[model samples]
Target: MGYAGRHVAALLQSLGVACSGTVRNVAVAPEVIRDAEAVLCTVPPDEDGDPVLRLLMKQLRDSASLRWVGYLSSTAVYADREGGWVDEQSDADAVDETARRRLLAERQWRALARDKGIASSVFRLPGLYGRGRNALVQLAEGRARHVVKPGLVFNRLHVEDLATAVVAAMRRAEPEALYLPCDDEAAAPQAVLAYAAALGGFEMPPAVAWDDPSLSPALRRFYAGCKRIDSRGTREALQWAPRFATYREGLQDAFRG
Candidate 1:
């Protein structure tokens, strides 16, 4: 949702369209924003259905003149594959707390949009990195570990790429469509950490087995599964491509800063 708002807001402002955003605290103020030419919802769904979603839907439905509703979701909602690949067409088999919660949230928002009669699309994003957000800095600071979770690989994207995807979707958002936003490469966690370590002029972090008792059971389970997402829908539909294709290039860019 943050990705949607930060970019879409600028996009709106660039076009001279009056815009207003809502959070859990400010959703009730839609009346103040009712005059907005477009309403791009960046609100995320809770583990349960978002209460504000119903309210937002009601407002969007009741508003006399409103256009555009976008829902932000996670690619983590995709089923864990134990190192298999998934696409927008794949089923969701959430394997951990975060993924399970996100899957539930995606379902709730889709249901709300259907019942409320709103034009909405969901963007499923991969691991996000940009600016100061890349893992290189963390690994450089000795906070990141290249865990040898060999079976798992994940697609990643820069925030700028994610931003452009949202803009592209808005340029052609339909009533109900699911979009997967990702870049070309999928790397194991250890691989990304190793790259980050190299950027910091250090050796890779020690390998830690998932069953190591030193690691919390919950965290171990979180790291137990791997996911590789397909981004063909995003590439074909949006006619988009990523600037940072791999961690090595991306980290070098990050390090240069």
Candidate 2:
């Protein structure tokens, strides 16, 4: 059902939900698609477009039992707001090539759901961190970076928050909905790194300018745009609130555990 199929399956199993998973081949096994009550797609778009949609658009469209379809998209779809606020309704004219493709995929998924008359939602998520995936893990393993870009802010969401939002969206059975699922506070990259270092009892990594020659091109591109994501529309629609509304609370949980 997703790229991180095993992780997702484990999470659902812990919640007492019987789940099955597949990686990158849901199209070949129509039975899996047919048997699924809901399908969550977490794959990223390629240069050609959404691989899942390209492969299984017909199967998904023909799925009579499919009650809900959720696509995990990125808030990068939004244009660079320069640390300003963007909500579900904001303009999504992203200049980045990957972001543009993501936006296209979002529209395609929504259109498919609309045509099939099924409940569907697209989640525009920010940088995701939780459990073993947070900054603490990075800092502990000596992989953390303090990339400094002044006046830049990025929102993040715990993986658990995303799971909660998905469940809420499914239960609500809302069709053709767009949501931004993010934490309460938006902060700079260095701030998160410093906080995580403090929580992990490690020295803060020295700041590196975004333009430093050692940075990877992908990392540089990640810091190219700055924006704060707002999830109020999603909160009101799903009646869901993030448990870890800020990086501080989330990092503390990770550190303690």
Candidate 3:
């Protein structure tokens, strides 16, 4: 959560928004957000379930002042489209364990809002990348890998664009809405890395087979899926588009930073 929350908090604070506090611990959410009118939950679900809903369901349901509730979810919840496009109305047949759990958590939040009449918005985010977490940083630290896999494509969102989308959602206070926020372009990891290398003036990292035994389990899982995600529905609904429309622009921004 620290990855996106800290950047988002900074952005919100700069916009003159009155943010009470960033809730680092779910157990203390009730106290931290006692008087908040709008709340954004970026907490990830564990094996048990969504920690925030599990811990602060009563407090959230009881808060009369709470108007807008936003839950940050992932695009992994959608089924693999084999490099095809998927949108908000697409089939959400989550195959992996993590995606399955996230789907359950999303349902829980939507149901909670319905039962309590709270304006709930779920933003299904794609792979996130920004200043300190982009290909530039990865290549600078010599940790960038070019995983060679045919027909593999991924959609990514710059953290700043995500921040913008979330703030727009807050302004509209859309009730019981689902959105998928991603950049305009979806490409392979190698293509992104090559672009980053050109900007950083370094040779691209050596290619690694997608099935290399040295790859971590998490990376293996990431490589297992190939899909192109589209957020046109979200853009139309929120009247917002990604500032960095593709990895090329996003990586350039990070490199400039």
Candidate 4:
């Protein structure tokens, strides 16, 4: 998400629009965001990988002077329906502890905009895939494992699309808007990995099930997640199209070099 923000921020700036990026829990260098107009925040691993939104609302409310505040949120805030599809209108269950914590933060930010009159918006993004972060690259290089879990699927968006949606949110400058951002396809873990390897012009590597007891708990939890989400709203509202609409498309570019 951080990398995606840089791409979008630079794009917006190149178009003659000044942009500001806020960093949470760190000393932001003045030069990183000296020229500013709108503020886009993609702060995380939220103070231990999930900071409550109240802290940010207080911090943001304390500082003002921007046309809009764009919050880069995650679709993990949605409930785990075990492969069932979820949309922006769906109720978020925040199944695991981390997601539950993220949900609380989202509620706080939404309230800050609605009741307190802060010009804010929420962008719930699906699983992100992009340059240097491609799962196949990670798996092939031994940084990540590709394990399939029953009843777990993932929706993905190329970072370019995520960045575009964020820019669209900022462009509209809506006082309090919520949008679900995702790509055109939802795929299983093995499917995503195989596609990446295919793009690399290599045969798909074999992998064990996530249920294999040899796996670590953290990896197991990550493999257990079902990243199903809908993004009709982004296309309708932003009038934006992704240059890399699918992970396959983006993965090809990542390995092309």
- Model 3 has an lDDT value of 0.84
lDDT string for model 3 (1-257, tens) is: 46777767777899998775445655566876677788787889887657778878888788888888888988888777788888888888878888877887888888888887878898888899998998888888998998999988888999998888888888888779888989988888999999999999988888999989999989988888888887888899999998999999888888878
* lDDT of candidates 1 onward, in order: 0.69, 0.83, 0.84, 0.68
Top candidate by TM-score = 3
Model 4 Cα lDDT, one tens digit per residue, 1-257: 26777778777778877665655433463334333345565665353433534334444454445356666777877666677778767887777776765666666666656664656778887767787788767866866566877667777888777777877777777777888878777878788777776656556556778878988887777776675666676678778767786777888778874
Candidate scoring better on TM-score of 2 and 3? 3
- Per-residue alpha-carbon lDDT of model 1 for 1-257, expressed as tens digits? 26547666666567765655555456356775566434555565555655455565566566656455566777766666877788878877677566766666666666655665755667887767866777777766777655566567778887767767777777775667788877778888788777777667777767887678888877676676678878887688878887777766777887888
**Weakest 10 consecutive residues of candidate 2 by summed lDDT:** 1-10
Clashes of 1: 1
- TM-scores for all candidates? 0.83, 0.92, 0.94, 0.83
Assess the local accuracy of residue 125 in candidate 3 as a C-alpha lDDT between 0 and 100.
86
Ranking by lDDT: 3, 2, 1, 4
Q: Each model's number of backbone clashes?
A: 1, 0, 0, 4
RMSD over all Cα atoms, model 2: 2.0
Q: What's the lDDT of the predicted structure labeled candidate 4?
A: 0.68
What is the Cα-based lDDT of residue 54 in candidate 2?
82
What candidate 4 gets wrong by more than 4 Å, as runs, is 20-36, 45-59, 62-64, 201-205
